[model samples]
Target: MSQSKITPKSYKVLAVDDNEDITELLEYTLSKEGYQVKTTWDGSTAIQLAQSFLPDLILLDISMPIMDGIEAGRLLRQIPALDYTFLIYLTARVEEYAEVAAFDIGADDYLIKPIKPRALVSRLKALLRDKNELAYSSTEFRIGDLKIDSLSYTINYQNKVLQLPKKEFELLYFLVQHQDTVYTREQLLSHVWGAGMHITPRTIDVHIRKIRERTGFDYIKTVKGIGYKFTTEPENT
Candidate 1:
C-alpha cells in the first residue's frame, strides 16, 4: 500500500470466478495486499455476496456455468448500493466486440485473463484513487426539465428519477456539462475514459447508444460523420 493513497485495508473486494483454483489464488493474492477480499466460484453466489458485502470493487470473470459475468455485472449495477462500485472484467475473451459489450454493461475497467497479482493491485489502487477525487467534486447540472446530481448519482428528468450505469452517467454528464460542443470519438474517449484506457472508439458508440436508450435521443445529438454533442432542444428529424 502506498502512503500517499488510501490504504488497501479500507477497501473491500469481491472476486468472482467459476474456477475454484482461480478464486483461491485471488483471495490469497488480494488478502496478502491488505484488501478485505471475499471470493465465490459462481456468479449467482457472487451476486448474493455482493448484496451483503457491498464491496468497493469487483473482479469478475466473463465465463461461468449458470450465470455469466455479464449478467452478474448487470444485476450488480442495478443494486443502488453498488452503483459506485468499480467492476473490472477478468476474462480470456480477446474479441473487440467482447470488450465493447463489457463497457456497455457499465464496467469500469477490463483486464484480459492470466491475472497478475501486482498489476491487478496497482490497477485497483488507481481506480480507488480516482474514486476519492470524484467524491470531492460537487457537480450538478440543470437544463430545462432535466437535472443531474453528481452527489446523489441520479438523474431527474420530467419529474421522473432515473439511474444510469456508471459509465453511461459519466459520459452523459461530460456531454451535458460541455453542451453543444461537438467532440470526435477520440476526444470523448480521452476526456471521459482517460487517455490510457485501452477501449476502442466503438466502446464510445455503445455507451452513447445506451445513454440514448435510457434518456431518449432528445438530449444527445449525433453529428453525422463526426461524433456526439449534448443539446437542450430537440434536433430536427
Candidate 2:
C-alpha cells in the first residue's frame, strides 16, 4: 500500500492597517503565497480579533483611528498567550527615532512605506522561516541564574518568570548560546534581525539596554570602538 502525501501547515498572518487598499493588497498577495491572511481596519478591532485568531505573524501600521499600533503592541505584549506572535511594523515614518521607538516596543521588523510587493512577501517568508526554525531548534537554555525556555518563550530570572518579546528573547538566546563571544553591531544585526533588513546598528543598542534593564544584569558587555558581547562572567559580580 502506498502512503499518502502530507502537506505542510500554512502560516497565519494578521494585517492591521487603516488603509483599505493596503489591506487588500496584502490579503491578495499573501493569499497567493499560501498564507492564511486576515485584515482589520483599526488597531482596537485587530487586538480583539488577535486574541481569538492567534495568528503566527502580525503586519501592523503605526497610525490609525481608535488606537494606534504602538498601543496595540503594548497591550499585546501583556498577554502571555500572544508572546510568540511576530510583529512587523509597516509605516511611512522614516525618522530614526520612530524606528527606535518601534523596536523598543517589541517590533521584530520595521518596513517603511512604498515597499515593493515582492520584497514584502520575501521579508514575510523570511520572518516565518526564522520563527519556525527557532521553534523547532531547542526548548531549554541555562546560563548562570538566567533560565531560558524557548518552548514557552519565558525566561526564569532569579526565581521570577519574565516574558521577553520575540526579538529580545532571540537576541538573548543567541548571545547566551555563544557566551563570551563578542559580536559586532553589524554582525549581531545580521544574525538576529536577518540580513537585508533596513535597520540601524543603534537598534541593537536599544534592545541590549532593554534586556539589561529587565534582567538587572550587565552580562552584555560593550567593547569600545567595537560592538557587544555576552559574558558569562558579568561585571560587578
Candidate 3:
C-alpha cells in the first residue's frame, strides 16, 4: 500500500512474501516499471488478493511461514479468477536442489534474489509479453481420452477432470504435442523450461511422480533412465 513508484500503464502484479521488506521492495520496484502492484506479507492473504484482483502475474517468495510460495501458487491456480495468471518464484535460495523443487511446484520462472531493479523489470516485461502471446494462442486440444483446455488451463481424462499441478499440466501439454514420441528429460526441460535455467534430470522425475499420484503415473512413460513420453490415453491407462 505504501507507494514509492508510479504505477505501470495498467497491469496488476501480486507480490507475496512473508518478509515485509521483500514485499515492499517488489512493490516499489515493480510499480516503478508501470505495473499496479499489490503486496501481501503472507500466503493466505496473497490468495485472497489474487482471488479478488486476479493479477496478470504473481511474484511469489519461496520461504514463508504457514503456506509457502509453492502452496500459494498451487492454490492460486485453482482460483477461477486467477487460474491463468503466471507465477514467478522470487527467492534468495538459488541452489540447484531447491530450484528443481521450485519448478516442480509450478513456477514459470524462478529469480535469484538481490535482483537488480532494472533487470527485474526487464524480466517481468518479457514474461508479460510472452504470456500475453500464449494466451491468445489456441488453448484447447483433444487427443483420445485426454483433453486439455488451454484457456481454462485445465485437463480432463476420459471426460473426468484430473487434478494436476501447474507443472504437471504443462508437462502433459508438451508431451501430448508429440504423442507416442518419447522425449528425454533433457529435451523435456529444454522445451518446457526453456534454456533460461540450469536444472537436473531429476526435476522431471519429481513432477512425474506427482502426476502419477493424481492420475496414476504409468501413463507418463519413462524410458528406463532416459526421458519420458505420454504413452497411453486414459482409455489406455
| Model 3 CA deviation exceeding 4 Å by range | 1-10, 18-21, 65-80, 95-97, 100-105, 232-237
Which residue pairs in candidate 2 collide? none
C-alpha-based local distance difference test score of model 1: 0.84
Instruction: Quote the positional error of residue 161 for candidate 3 in Å.
Output: 2.8
TM-score per candidate: 0.86, 0.90, 0.75
Q: lDDT tens digits, residues 1-237, model 2?
A: 843332213678899999999999999888887888899988899889999999888899999999998888878777767877888999998889888988888889999997588999888877777776666656688887989887677889889999778888889988988888989999999998888888999899999989888878888888888888888787842
Tens digit per residue, CA lDDT, model 3, 1-237: 742332246688888888888878888887777788889877888988888887888988878887877787777766766655778888888677777767666667778887678877877776666545445565677776778876556778767886565556777788877878888988887877666645676778887777777765356777776677876543233
Question: Which is better, 1 or 3, measured by TM-score?
Answer: 1
lDDT, model 2, position 124: 80
Per-residue alpha-carbon lDDT of model 1 for 53-75, expressed as tens digits? Answer: 99999999988988999888888
The candidate scoring highest on lDDT is 2
